[model samples]
Target: MAADDIAGLIREAIPDAVVEITDLAGDGDHYAAKVISESFRGLSRVRQHQAVYAALGGRMGGVLHALQLTTAVPT
Candidate 1:
């Protein structure tokens, strides 16, 4: 999948999110994403990852695989 597509999906789930995607393997499948949003402020790391996975709408294990996600609230 494209980086823009990943960012778009995240943005759709978290409207106020700031997403940055990096193709770790340059193979379109492996990626590292940084998502910053107020929604993650009080949530745990697991919860934050869950939120992002939910945003992907089941694409995590399907079309998209091997994602390294980092989430944080804007300072």
Candidate 2:
């Protein structure tokens, strides 16, 4: 999938999130994403990552091969 598609999915889940998606390998299968949202403020790192993965709705191991994900609360 495309970077924009990934970003869109995250945005849809977290309306106020700032999502930046990078195509790490330039192959469209490897990606790096930085997600910032107020909703993540009190969540554990694993939970934050889970929220993101949930946004993808099972696309992670399927259509999306690899994703380097970093999530944080808005500064």
Candidate 3:
């Protein structure tokens, strides 16, 4: 799970998304992602996170270990 791959997945799912992924532990397994998109405008915080998770296509607990996620509607 490279940072670019994570970003790509998010972008694929949310075409207008701006995704930033950080390699937290300097390891491919741990990450922190900030996803911004207009698509999240009316969604709840939990739903916003879920959307991002869904974009990963079930890679969350498998190939990717831990992700600290932050999502927002673009300002």
Candidate 4:
């Protein structure tokens, strides 16, 4: 639930990704993550989000409650 935990999960899934996570609610549950990676180059926004969600390994709607995710390809 910590910011590092969220960033760690994303980094684990996308090894080359640059992850920046912010604790939105200061409660360790709500977060906002900005991910930049070459892997997301051709993926749609939804697909990118899905990838992030998958990276969480089913923790999206469970232990992690809310996440505002933004993904982009590295320029």
- Weakest 10 consecutive residues of candidate 1 by summed lDDT: 57-66
Global fold similarity of model 3 (TM-score): 0.97
Measured against the true structure, the TM-scores of the candidates, in listed sequence, are 0.96, 0.98, 0.97, 0.95
Clash totals in order: 0, 0, 0, 0
Alpha-carbon local distance difference test for all models? 0.95, 0.96, 0.94, 0.92
Candidate 1 wrongly placed segments (more than 4 Å): none
Tens digits of per-residue lDDT, candidate 1, 1-75, equal 899999999999999999999999999999999999999999999999999999999998778988999999999
Angstrom error at residue 26, model 2 = 0.4
Query: Residue-wise lDDT of candidate 3 within 2-70, one digit each (tens)?
Result: 899999999999999999888989979999999999999999999999999999999989999999999
The deviation in Å at residue 29 for candidate 1 is 0.6
Residue 40 displacement in candidate 3 (angstroms): 0.1
Which digits, one per residue and each the tens of the lDDT, describe model 4 over residues 1-75?
A: 788988999999999999999898898889999999899988899999999999999998789999998999988
- Highest lDDT: which candidate? 2
Candidate number of the best TM-score: 2
Q: What is the descending TM-score order? A: 2, 3, 1, 4
lDDT of 3 at 15: 97
Query: Each candidate's root-mean-square deviation in Å?
Result: 0.6, 0.4, 0.6, 0.7
Give me the runs in candidate 4 sitting further than 4 Å from their true place.
Answer: none
